[model samples]
Target: MSAAVPPVRKERNNMRARAALMSPALLIIGGFLVAPLFVVLVYSFLTPGTYGGVIWEWTTDAYVQFLFEKDIFDETLIFSTAYLQIYSRSFVQAAASTAICFLIGFPTAYFIATRPAAQRNMWVLLVTVPYWINLLIRTIAMLFLVRDNGPLNHLLLSWGIIDEPIHIAYTNFGVGIGLVYSYLPFMVLPIYATIERFDFRLVEAAFDLYADRWTVLWKIILPLCAPGVIAGSLLVFIPSLGAFIAPDLLGGGKNLMIGNLIAMQFQASRNWPFGAAAAMILMTIVLVTLIFYARRQGRSTVRLH
Candidate 1:
């Protein structure tokens, strides 16, 4: 005879309780995030009905419009046949923001990570202080500080540099400044996490071997911290790609990043399918980049090992 089977009822009860507890959070995220994403995927492949409804028929019209009929679909692309300007500009802005964030953040992270343990927390807090301020509020504060009659112009006027105020606010330059400022903390935190966990004695050994500082930086420190560089770059670039208020208010309609285009469709044009298609396109681009980054990082790791 088979051994007596243990009761499974108790095990089932435990499983049910766990699922019940997790259900609420799962429901909320699925309802808000996953559901909307699936809807976008569906909208991209389906037709856009009149009065902002989706037709039940399968079609590629929205994606086609994104590629060919850009003017009719995208607001900033109107009155021009340069169909991909918005996509191109968005790429440029995101790339520039990532580069600048890295250049400015790496050293700061290094310093903070190497400081005395007692001082590290204070420096990290100082780096993060700007994040506590509201994004829109911080962006608007920049506008006032750089506006024609603001402190910058006031100072220039006082120093006898120019008789008239310079146009600093409401420009691409202003938008870039805001992007860098808003995203700086994201860049710093990841790199700090990286540099903090570094094996500093390796650099000291490189120094004992009579290696120059630049050589040690290039061959030892940088290669050792490749993960951090990738982490910080991803953190900075992805979010800046979809930054809304910063470019909208600072660029003053002159700059047309992809984020603004997506927002315009939902809010101004009220075309849900087209907006969903645009978003799917942005998602595809981001996915492609991440795949490439991961592949490269994997290859580097293999080489190092």
Candidate 2:
């Protein structure tokens, strides 16, 4: 018979086995995620080359240039608000999209969650049906729908809603609509998952105690499903903040978000260091937001317990 291994040896062997199993994932994260981020961080601190790429010399010009513009004649740094406006626009758009998604998605998720178990799947399937189509195709379809001579305008005209077609396509309004359409599913799914697991007994008890619909919703339902709501908000808000497609196509190059600004720096402007700096700043903001949300969530959970 084989001899039994010592406890210490067995523990070491188990750790080795675990590490062996994790090696592939570790390598993938290191190679793909971490390495790329490191490269971008390094590039952010470098000087932009005359042509396109970054120079070997390290400098903070890229970061400084974000808030200040250098004059061509005297080369004095002048405070600029153009980039700040773009960032503000992106944040406003993202926040608006998240709020709209929550308003629409909450009811939709509640409807789906309250449905018979057999029917719930069909509702979810319908919700996700749009995703099967390519995003570009869907965006283009939205553009066509919102165009001056499109079916939406035709329908509104027929209903005598307006004297003329409303201009939606190639505008910020169209971009907002596109963002809500794109990320609504993200909000719905998380909320549905949370509400599906909720106990109806508590709701019945609240009703029995003479609690009103709004009271039950605010006190019980919303508090219980806050996790999913927060998750969906993050899912929608983060992507919407960095959204390229909606602003690019719907806004028609007229209204530029932060994503478009970063792309312009890299592609049209040929300012690699500036683009890298923008990306790093965006990443930092997202990280800080995530940390803030995480801590708040932890505190809520502690209070609940």
Candidate 3:
């Protein structure tokens, strides 16, 4: 029928218009993200070339190398635990940094969220000011401040806190401090966003019901801020796990994380396959974490509803 034909034709035109609008974004994702990930996945299965390239030959040696190293002369697989130790260390540092960020960021975000709207923007700008400078520059600045004979040590020495300059710059302590400083804004902004939308009347109600400050915060404020906290933790944890610059500069290259390992594989070791495998493993872990987090959040939402 002619009437049906017009409606069907209009529907096709609408579909075509939508497809046209989405095509650029779809192409970019496919070309950049999906293609590179596919390349890495394929590289993980291939053999490493003798001279710093892939051989295109299928092999499981990369994954095997993660846990064991082949004996140079015996041609036997020797169980090695060094990489495992590195991974464990990476996890510990990431977790500790996340905890520190949360401890510091929660109060800072709360303070910001409690400020009047006119003043809030300035406070947020201060939080984000460090981001304007290059990360490497900011990290180097930290090194300057914390290094032995640096300003912090000089100040401590002037104040007679200790007889000699303390070695805080090139240690795990320095790395932790750098990580917390670098990622603090990420932790603060998310929690601040969540708290800004929170209803203050609920706080007043809790207080009116004879709830103390601690009780209101523990029960009402934190629970309402849960989404932001989770988001910020993920943002901080994932990157901190793969942190390279802070550890390299602050940890003095003595402390190596998974990111450093990956970089070493590609650059120093000239082992593309192993690097690809490590990258894949890292991606898989992050993916699993995100999925678990998303499911937990969904369940919590359902319960809240």
Identify the candidate with maximal TM-score.
2
Q: What root-mean-square deviation over C-alphas does model 1 reach?
A: 4.3
For residue 254, give model 3's deviation from the true position in Å: 1.7
- The number of the candidate with the highest lDDT is 2
Model 2: residues with Cα > 4 Å off, grouped in runs? 1-3
Give Cα distance to truth, residue 120, candidate 2, Å: 0.9
Candidate 2's displacement at residue 141, Å, is 0.9
TM-score of predicted model 1? 0.85
Error of 3 at 125 (Å): 0.5
Runs in model 1 with CA error above 4 Å? Answer: 1-33, 49-51, 55-57, 70-83, 160-164
lDDT of 3 by residue, 207-274 (tens): 99999999999999998889999999999999999999999999998878899989988887899999
How many clashes in each candidate? 0, 0, 0
Per-residue lDDT tens digits of candidate 2, residues 1-305?
22577888888999999999999999999999999999999999998877899889999999999899898689999999878888889999999999999999999999999999999999999999999998878998999899899999999999999989999999889999999999999999999999999999999999999999999999999999999999999999999999998899999988999889889888889999899999998888889999999999999988878
Ranking by lDDT: 2, 3, 1
Give me the overall lDDT of model 3.
0.92
lDDT on C-alpha atoms for all candidate structures: 0.85, 0.94, 0.92
The residue-level lDDT of candidate 2 at 110 comes to 99
